[model samples]
Target: MGKRNITDEEIGLIKAMLKRGMRNDEAHFHFNRQDRLISPGRIAQIKSGKYGGDVAIANDTALDQFLAESQQRSGAPAKAARLSGPDWGETFEADGGGGFRVRGGETDTVECKLSFRMNPNRFAEVVKSIAGMANNKGGMIPFRGT
Candidate 1:
């Protein structure tokens, strides 16, 4: 039979199954039982990072790369599930933390929080910024460390 084109989500589930100590045959059988078309050999290939396809992932870095490529292919704006302070393309210096010191500072999407919440207004501003980010194409809200 022809190879089934699996979604990234399915690939993630397979990865999870592998992490849970399930063998390739077990994962294949599990999926097949759920009516999903995946083979034990294919599952092994995916885990070995030899799956010659777009959804290839070997580790965290590879997964990040795969997700970025997938997002780019879909022509959809990147969604932020965590704080990725800055992009590699951006001109900035790392402060040895999950933050950046941009040369020119905040852009249309990048926002900075310089201090802790001292009052209701400041807390409200932070909340609004988070909501704005979630509602938009998603972005990083870097908070300065004291």
Candidate 2:
């Protein structure tokens, strides 16, 4: 598939996000929406100064404004959960109630667990799954059950 092109303004925001202590994966999650795709690798390149080196970092005020605007656009609360898969293809957002809404089905980067048990076997499985995700591109696993 063709990758979405990122604009200079977005590059500035990415730089600012990194400078402000946001992880590359988290930055990728924030910027890579369903309609837009910013690869984690691209975020890494920006973090390492291999890309967007000429773009200026966005100011604090601009960053705040951008984040606010993003929340508004997504119709999410001030502290709603926003997550994406490794390919930056799918997005999961808070439903404003107590649940989350996902746009696509499970992928290599997105796993959904209907319930989570605290038993030793379940805990081991969860840890192994998380480690696998970390080894690959970062991913999100939202436990729906208590």
- Top candidate, metric lDDT: 2
TM-score of each: 0.31, 0.54
lDDT tens readout by residue for model 2, 52-97: 7888889999999998887666554544344545733345556678
lDDT of each: 0.59, 0.72
Output candidate 2 Cα RMSD.
9.4
Among these predicted structures, which one has the highest TM-score?
Answer: 2
lDDT of 1 by residue, 1-79 (tens): 2565766666775686677676675445334433555665778877876664455334656545654665465343443
Error of 2 at 143 (Å): 9.7
The CA lDDT at 72 in model 2 is 69
Which pairs, if any, clash in model 1?
Answer: none
Off by over 4 Å in 1: 1-4, 33-36, 52-146
